[model samples]
Target: MILETRGIGKRFGSVLALRDVSMGVRAGEVTCVLGDNGAGKSTLIKILAGVHQHDAGTLLVDGREVRLTGPRDALDRGIATVYQDLAMIPLMSVWRNFFLGSEPRKGLAFDVARARRVAREELKAMGIDIRDVDQPVGTLSGGERQSVAIARAVHFGARVLILDEPTSALGVKQAGVVLRYIARARDRGLGVVFITHNPHHAYPVGDRFLLLNRGAGMGEYGKADITPQELTSLMSGGAELEELAHELRRE
Candidate 1:
């Protein structure tokens, strides 16, 4: 396993945000974290990204227990998180945004040519087809922007990629575009942590599924252990959904 959480729990003030959640992601596989709003998905991502520490249980990286001090700590450990906000400057060029902080230095000056070349090469390696490296990021479609972020993480040596709702705002075609890049990353031997509420999105590329409901775990299942219907039903609260349908039925 590349990353594993054993019975992990997180608490904020008196309210416990997560409890007894055990899940792991292996190299060259995608582990989908599926939940609706307020399902503690963000809490779990925060812990994994080193934005917050787990209050209980253990977090293991490559079988060794450790505590991350902050986001930098996680990155140094080869755990990279690309939040939904994307954190990309819209006005910046694609290549500029790709090498935002860690720009290559040539005698105390930024290497613009090298940055553009490397960014284009990295994006191509991941099979992401961005039209131009010099185009403004905001001009690209949402899925293309996400592709840049994913490619950036992979190029920078991310052993584990934690994506926060990459496809939530995209249309059907765009979502498929992003999903294709995700599979590409997995194929390249990177363990991907794909967090999304859509079972439709999760079912296709996921090797394993982690279901969270109201700050607790529903369960985790390998793809072979559960069908797509079961995954959608379980994450959407099968019994509750039925009850809701009946409650809203015409008289």
Candidate 2:
């Protein structure tokens, strides 16, 4: 396993954000985290990404118990998170954004030629067909931006990629584009933690599913053990969807 949490719990003063949440992420596989708002999905990934520390239970990376101090600490440990916002500068060129913080340098000067070549090569390698690397990031489509972020993470040596609600804001076609890139990443042997509220988006690409509700776990199931319909029902808290179905039925 690339990453695992056992009985993990978190608290925010009087509120408990997560309790007894356990899941594992493996290399070359996608672990879909399904949840509604306030379901502790964000909290759980925050802990995994080192933005927050768990107050209870254990977090293991490569089979060793370790406390993550902050985001950089997590990155240093080969765990990288690509949040929905993506953290890319809108005005920057693709190559510049690709190596924003860790830019390659030649004797105290940025290696412009090398950076450009690498950025272009990496995107092409991932089957992303961007017209120009010189284009400003803000001009790219939402799906294109996401593809760039995923490629950046992979290029920077991320072993486990935690993506927070990656497909939430995209249209159907754009979402499909991002999903293909995710499959490409998994194919390249990166463990992908895909967090989203959409079961339709999760069901197609997920190898395993972990459902979260009200800051607690519903259960974890492999794709073979759970159907898409079952996953949607559980994610919506079962009764709520049934209630909606009854209310919407024709007279």
Candidate 3:
């Protein structure tokens, strides 16, 4: 396994956001975290990304206990998270954004040309099509930006990629594009944690499913253990759906 959390819990003063949440991600597989709003999904990802200190839990990387103090700590351990915001500077060119804060240095100068070439090559290698690496990041479509972010994470040696709502704002076609990059990331042998509310999006690529409701885990299921319809029903409230169906029936 690439990453694991045992009995992870987070609290905000008196309220518990998560309780005893244990999940694992393995190389070459995608673990989809499906939850409704306020279901502790964000809290879990934040803990994994080191954005928040867990109130209680054991975090393991490669089966060894480790303390993730902050985002840098996570990155140092080869765990990278691409948030919903995409994190690309809008006015900056793609290549510039790609090398932001970690630019290639050639004799005390940023290697601008090298960065552009490398950014272009890396995207191409990942099967991402970009008209030019010098285009401002804002000019790229949402899916393209997400793909660029994913490519950046992989190029930087991310062993585990935690994505937060990657396809939430995307249209069907754009979502499809991002989904392809996700599969590509998994194919390259990186363990992936995909957090989303979209069942259709998760069902196709996920190898394992984790469902959360109101800051608690319902359960985790393998792909073979649950169908997409079943997963959706669970997410939408199985009993609630049945009640609504019964209420809507006309005699």
Best by lDDT: 1
The best-first sequence of candidates by lDDT reads 1, 2, 3
Quote each prediction's TM-score. Answer: 0.96, 0.95, 0.95
Report the lDDT tens digits of candidate 2 across residue range 1-69: 989999999999999999999999999999999999999999998999999999999999999999899
Off-target runs (Cα >4 Å) in candidate 3 are 243-251
lDDT per residue, candidate 1, 1-251, as tens digits?
98999999999999999999999999999999999999999999999999999999999999999999999999999999999989999999999999999999899999999999999999999998888999999999999999999999999999999999999999999999999999999999999999999999999999999999998988899999999999888976897988888989953
Which residue pairs collide in model 3, if any? Answer: none
Lowest lDDT sum, 10 consecutive residues, model 1, at 242-251
**Which rank order by TM-score, best down to worst?**
1, 3, 2
Clashes of each: 0, 0, 0
Name the lDDT of candidate 1: 0.96
Global lDDT for candidate 2? 0.95
Better of 1 and 2 by lDDT: 1
